[model samples]
Target: MVALRNLLTALFLPVKLCLFVFHHRVGRVRAARAAGDRGAISIELALAVIVLVGIAVAVLAVVMRLANTVKGKVPTDPVVTAAP
Candidate 1:
């Protein structure tokens, strides 16, 4: 029972330590955010907008390529009518 307890403690000690550090770091970030840290928010928003625009551009390129491929395979010449 003692050995099992020791093993469990060894496994969980690092996890607990990490959680403690993360909790404190998050608290400090929250405090800073509450203290009027607007620049980070703006930067994050800009990055998000840039990412969305990039995705839109990529999708547009793919659609254009598909349109061109389909257009190439289509028969564009006019059909002739038979004489009566």
Candidate 2:
């Protein structure tokens, strides 16, 4: 049994070494692809944020104009006078 075990170990050592090297190389490739994806996502996020901010500013400007118009049309005088 010990001899059989030794023989099997010797036979499989090369296959194990090949697998280890393949996994290490694949891991490096995956890490490089992930780095590129991160940069692209960051740029897209920045552009989206800028567009949202522009929309918010435009909405605020329109609201301010409408508020001013309403304020100008409203009368300051009371509608009903209080009894003395």
CA lDDT, every prediction?
0.77, 0.74
- Candidate 2 clashes between residue pairs 3 or more apart in a chain or in different chains: none
Q: 1-84 in candidate 2: lDDT tens per residue? A: 999999999989967866785576557557757777656555655675687679769979999999998898788645887889
Off by over 4 Å in 2: 1-36, 76-84
Clashing pairs in 1: none
Candidate 1's residue-wise lDDT over 4-57, tens digit each?
999999989967965785576567567768998867756755675687679769
Against the true structure, whose lDDT is highest?
Answer: 1
Error of 1 at 8 (Å): 53
Q: Which residue runs does candidate 1 get wrong by more than 4 Å?
A: 1-35, 76-84
- Could you tell me every candidate's TM-score relative to the true structure? 0.49, 0.47
